[model samples]
Target: MVRSNAYDLPTISVQGEIDHPRLRSLGFVDPSGHAQLVALGTSGIAYDVRIGDRAVGWAADHVEPGVSIRHSDVEANLALAYNSCVGNRAIVVSGRAQGAEGVVTGKHGGALPTDRLLVDFSPDVLDKLVIGDSILIRSRGQGLVLPDHPGVSVRNLDPNLLDRLPISEVGGVLSVGVAARIPARVMGSGIGMGSVALGDYDINLFDAQTVEEFGLDRLRLGDLVHLEDTDNRFGRSYRKGMSTIAVVAHSDSVLAGHGPGVVTLFSGSDEDLVAVDDPAANLADIWRV
Candidate 1:
């Protein structure tokens, strides 16, 4: 018999907010001719699109007709650890294609899916990807786990703003880092929003204007947000002093039930963090001892 919670289990909590006054003006309307106040489903979340070697901000899928999901204020993934791997190498661990390898385009976030390390292969290679298949990432930069450093923290972020912010780079690399820790209680609707109940948290990356205007820019993509240890049932706190780590990716995706970018990693119990004002600080400077 197939066991449930085997792969991609849900372990987070989500709440809805009804303060979107501009949603209707943007053409979102209900059947009553008023601004449609639909519950932002798990489709509104998204991840930063990495085209070549750039973080292209956040992009969500269709929410309503004519209301295309644009790059809004959102947070990027934080808590990144560099592994020992070269570029363009593939490492397949899970799924039916276990032992199969793909090309490593580059690393984006700290973890795997949440910190989505981009891997490119032929269409035939992608065809082998299964739902429960775990990717064995290999390279000179592999298995670099996020340290429970006291200087790091994260908060709930908005995705819309992440799509608009200008790109920042360091040593020709994208300059992204975590700002603070956020409880899973603040995550909203999107594909992984359902996965939140599975002990995962979505990352946001945007600007402040988007936060006040559409609440999108409040976060950026690379923010290292924290997930409170809690029971998926009743959405109650489980480990009073424990938590997990995930990087914000996006709100939705082109594939069904596969929106947003998430990379999950096992964290220790006493991983404390603090907030920083500028998230775009150079990685070398911030992580410097």
Candidate 2:
């Protein structure tokens, strides 16, 4: 078994409310220079979209599936983003959906006013949810460390989920199963950010050729993807022979330099962290949601 310091990690409570969807009056321009407007940004409860839904082909930009949540206060929202981890438990504390349970899925970070936390809930629960409903997240898993593999850094992943991952160690090398292996060149927006603790960077699918070659169109919202030659340790950057594993957080965008959002989960050198193809390597599949 892989050893970790997960047991020593402390869990905290962070509260947030369902965020309302946003749209700019001026609309947006796509990569082809076409001015267009559509449903975009964070939504209270995305009824048609869920963890296993297709991320591409959506008429939205940076659109979060399921429920998008954030604290009304800026500083508190920051805490909610930084402290919450994927696979953490979320509870609806107020509103018609009170007592409903969900799972923290991912975080949205980019050129936005605030970072939003994504949560996955059942359809019935989502139907009852409304904008501004309070949610209490049992946040944990920030300071996680693999005792045997010092080169690998873990971020934004819950300890319980970590234990259930399709991970195996052989000859001091950790092999992690992922849904897709994305090239580093496709990474865009939020690229130069100095922190991976909260939010996410984009996966650029603007190039049709690259998209076909990578089969990126098939990418789903909860899929685990490996970023080749990427380093998200301190910030997002290209480091030779490095690898970063991240989860697809939000849907595709019509704008340039932006596509589906992916939040960092693990980072290290290719020698230390190897990616293995596993089609079922998705959060939705793992959790059977």
lDDT of each: 0.30, 0.90
Best by TM-score: 2
RMSD of each: 15.2, 1.2
lDDT of 2 at 250: 91
Off by over 4 Å in 2: 111-113
Error of 2 at 50 (Å): 0.6
Report model 2's TM-score to 2 decimal places. 0.97
- Please count the clashing residue pairs in each candidate, in the order shown: 97, 1
Taking the tens digit of each residue's C-alpha lDDT, what string does model 1 give over 72-190?
21231121112312132345555555566543322222223232333433444445654334444332322222222322221221122122223233232222334334444433323
Ten-residue stretch with the least lDDT total in model 1: 62-71
